[model samples]
Target: MKTASRWAIHVVPGLNSFAYGRIAIQGDAAHAMTPYNGSGVNQAIEDAYVLGRMLTHPKTTMETVESALKAYDSVRRERAQGVQELSLQLGRLATFTEDLQLQPGADPIAVTAARLEAAGIWVGEGDLEDDVRKAEENFTKFIAKA
Candidate 1:
């Protein structure tokens, strides 16, 4: 190659919440992460799906929208933050920079492969419907308290 360029990966710090009152953030706006786990888009989609469900619930209305958004935050914040952390861990593993937390005499390669596989399993499996249901339930409870 005549020339080569290096690009830096940027990640957003994981936030405590994704919504405030009626305002909410999704995708990279909320939890930007490294590409090692390739889960940024997926987490965004999950955010959208859950928020959409909250906004469209029959019990949701102008007066209750803020609560709905808060409900979305309650449901998605933890999960998205978790994925964000996992993505960073995967990046460390991919770069061979992670400590790997090996035991005495453990094979580094095998440990890395096992860790990668565990991360893959987490990335690959989820229940979006359950998340949406939980958000809706939270919204209902919030409105009930009002």
Candidate 2:
């Protein structure tokens, strides 16, 4: 085997997960992982929240329910992974004690400030309910192909 220069491993803590749509899968049965930033548990909890909402909705069809679940995946995945990536990026700076990688809209601050500012913009976009609803409507009408 070729020798690799670096290796990293993650230890996933136990947990439960659930989703809605004509069906529900719960607990570690749905998702299982330990994030370096301790976000895994919170994300799993969000699943529990939306899953319950989906279950209680009368308009919930296998299709609609599935759609909601897909929405949840899109939203939650972005939120959780975004934070996780930020934390990992931060760890890199802390470990290296160097300047941040400059990219789009990047400024000349130290790595930590740049990272936090970028993270703020990533997270500061608000009115999530309205945003998702607008996005879904747009997808259904304009963007989606039959």
Candidate 3:
């Protein structure tokens, strides 16, 4: 096996929104997280999915692109940031980092295992269709107000 001389993990602070005006950021650019839960790519894909839906809506136009981007931000920001935080917490738990506080009588190994299971469940427990629908609704409302 080839050994590399250096390794680094870079993460960005979570943001409240991923879009500003017509320019929207997705993937690692928006929410960078630790690799503990292996969710970075998944979250990026989700961002793309929602943004794609918003931008492709029949009613979307140059005049309303900003609203589409805002709708994308509204639907994706909270969920992506949540995954970012969960990924960070999983990293802490996996490494038994001091960031996690064990309750009295709590078994460290068991706790980590439980958290891992929950993360797996949570990662798989959302409806992409529902998310797209919500983004569409938000885009429509925003366009109406413009």
Which 10-residue window in model 1 sums to the lowest lDDT? 1-10
TM-score of 3: 0.90
**Model 1 per-residue lDDT tens digits across residues 1-146:** 77768778788897878888779999999998888788899899988989888888888889999899999998899888889899889888888999877889999989999999998898778788888888888888989997
The superposed Cα distance between candidate 3 and the true structure at residue 102, in angstroms, equals: 4.1
Return the top candidate by TM-score.
Answer: 1
Candidate 1: C-alpha RMSD to true structure equals 1.8
In the order shown, the candidates' Cα RMSDs to the true structure are 1.8, 8.4, 2.2
Off by over 4 Å in 3: 1-5, 98-103
Ranking by lDDT: 3, 1, 2
TM-score of 1: 0.93
Q: Residue by residue across 1-146, what tens digits does model 2's lDDT show?
A: 58888666553322222234435553334544433344456556665665555445565454565555554444454454555565566556556655555677865456566565666575455455653554355334422332
Error of 2 at 40 (Å): 3.2
Residue-pair clashes per candidate: 0, 5, 0
Per-prediction TM-score, please? 0.93, 0.49, 0.90
- Rank the candidate models, highest TM-score first: 1, 3, 2
Q: CA lDDT, every prediction?
A: 0.88, 0.50, 0.88
Ten contiguous residues with the weakest lDDT in model 3: 92-101
RMSD in angstroms between candidate 2 and the native structure over all alpha carbons: 8.4
